[model samples]
Target chain A: MHELSIAKNIIEIVKESVEEKDLSEVDKVVLKIGDLSGVVPASLLFSLEAITNNTELENAGYEVINVPFIVKCNTCGKESNNEAGIVRCTLCGSNDTGIISGNELLVSEIILKN
Target chain B: MSVITVERKILAKNDEIAEQNRELLKQNDVFTINLVSSPGSGKTSLLEKTISLIGSKVNISVIEGDVQTSLDAERVANYNVPVVSIVTNGACHLEAKLVQDAINNLDLAKTELLFIENVGNLVCPAGFDLGEEMKIVVVSTTEGDDKPLKYPKMFRNSDVMIINKIDLIPYVNCDISKLKDNALLINPGLKIFEVSCTSGEGIKEWCNWLIENVKGKYIHQTQLVY
Candidate 1:
């Protein structure tokens, strides 16, 4: 799965942060995974756990903040949370809508151990 | 005890490389398309058809991405076009760095359009940007009409959706209308084309649209240059 690569990417980012901040160890890594990001949180967490084994991040807990897919209808100026993952206006029935959120795949925070 | 604020994209490295590629392609006046699909969704077949139809009118090059083997590259080479194959070894998708490497091997000056046949997987490729002008997702009738709904991210991310293998529609359980409806629901702005690579059904329309796009890009570039 691509999550393996994503997990490795997260570790790389964390490692860079650690080096720059002079942190001893990582306690947890916080991620913001959106519904439309095409990433499965469980699979990504599993990959992180497996790869972090025997490494400095072995005991680091992974925190994923689930973000719902929301869209803003340009026609009606109505915002709707689309659980079905479709980008459509709920009120004005306009297809011309922009994604308000939900495509995020970012590392928001990293907790360092004392 | 301390929480470090790091609001950064996990695929920032890839995105950076992708942006570099976009700049590079723009400078070279090369219009690129990243073709993505399931393992057996006839991506190669569609490419073969596209090349054959438009090769005489325009200059084309190809970068074939596969987990292993140079089979697709060999197939594309039969058309006498400049082709490069990127064997990911075991990677599920083609990253921007890999594509950047492939771009270095092609003659972009002579290439009007570059077709990157991405590794055959709908999910992972949707997330990775290879600096293509557009991403085209191919879905065959045999895969069923629910593909768009099942893999909404691919449909949503793709600018163009090519419904391939329409020749098998009579035997398959897929409803073409339903598939279009589902895809349109996910992405209302998607440009769709239905084609049968074997029967040469809608290849002309696809090629005409492609040529128009290439010409449009060329004209835009010329305008900027002047």
Candidate 2:
């Protein structure tokens, strides 16, 4: 699964960051995954556990925050959370719109002990 | 015991590597295209057809990315074009770092067009950019016409949507209009092409479009030079 690949990336990033900051140990990793980002949190978490088992992040835990999809209505100029597969404006019922948010997949914060 | 709060993006590292790869390709004057699709969507077949049509017109090279096996690379090699196969070894997508390495091993001096055929997965490939100038997402009629709606990100990220296996449309239940509509809804300006690589149907127009676009970009760059 792609989750494994993404997990590898996460591990590599954490490893580099810890080395750069001279951190002794990682406590927890906080991530924000958007609804439209095409990543499954559970799958990523599982992969992360396996990948970090023998690495510096062996005992590190993960905290995932799910972000809802938000779109800006072109007709009404209103932004609101949107359900999956639905891109129409909630207020004006128009298909003219732009994606405002919910496509992000980022590590928001990481907790480390020095 | 001091706790440090590191607010960092997880993909930041990968994105940084991707930017470096982009710069390398730009400096080489190589136009790269990342081809993505579901398994058995005829991605390789389309490449074969593409190679046959434009192999002599331009300098083409391929970076074949797959979880395993060198089957696709071998196919492209028969066209006498330079090919480098990168086995992800079970990974679903190709990352920028991998492409960077592949490009380093390639002869970019004679290469004008570089095609990176990503692993056959609709969802995962969209999240990664391999320093490509454009992305082409292939969807076969046999895979259902609702794929564009189900996987909006892949379609939206793609510059061109190639509808392959059009010959199977008569034997299968597919609505071309619905597929086009859904894809256009996600990306209104997406260039669309329908072709059957097996039957050589509607492939001439597709090749013509590709050649024209590549030539146009090259000529535009020439104008900027003068």
Q: Which numbered prediction scores highest in TM-score against the true structure?
A: 1
Off by over 4 Å in 1: A20-24, B219-226
Q: What is model 1's DockQ versus the real complex?
A: 0.81
Model 1 lDDT per residue over A1-114, tens place:
999999999989998887644433788889999998889999999999999888777888989999888999988988999855688787777999998899999999999887
Per-residue accuracy of model 1 over B1-226 as CA lDDT, tens digit each: 8898999999999999999999999999899999999999999999899888889878999999999999999999999999999999999999999999999999999999999999999899989988999999999999999998988899998999999999999999999999999999899989999999999998988888888788786454222110
In model 1, state the lDDT of residue B45: 93
- TM-scores for all candidates? 0.95, 0.90
lDDT of 2 by residue, B1-226 (tens): 3444555666666678888877887788888899999999998999899898888887899999989899999998999999999999988899888988999899987988889999999999998877788899999999888998899889878999999999998899999989998887677778999999999997878877777666776564222110
Q: State residue A64's C-alpha deviation in candidate 2, in Å.
A: 1.0
Chain A TM-score across all models, in listed order: 0.92, 0.90
Which candidate's lDDT is highest?
A: 1
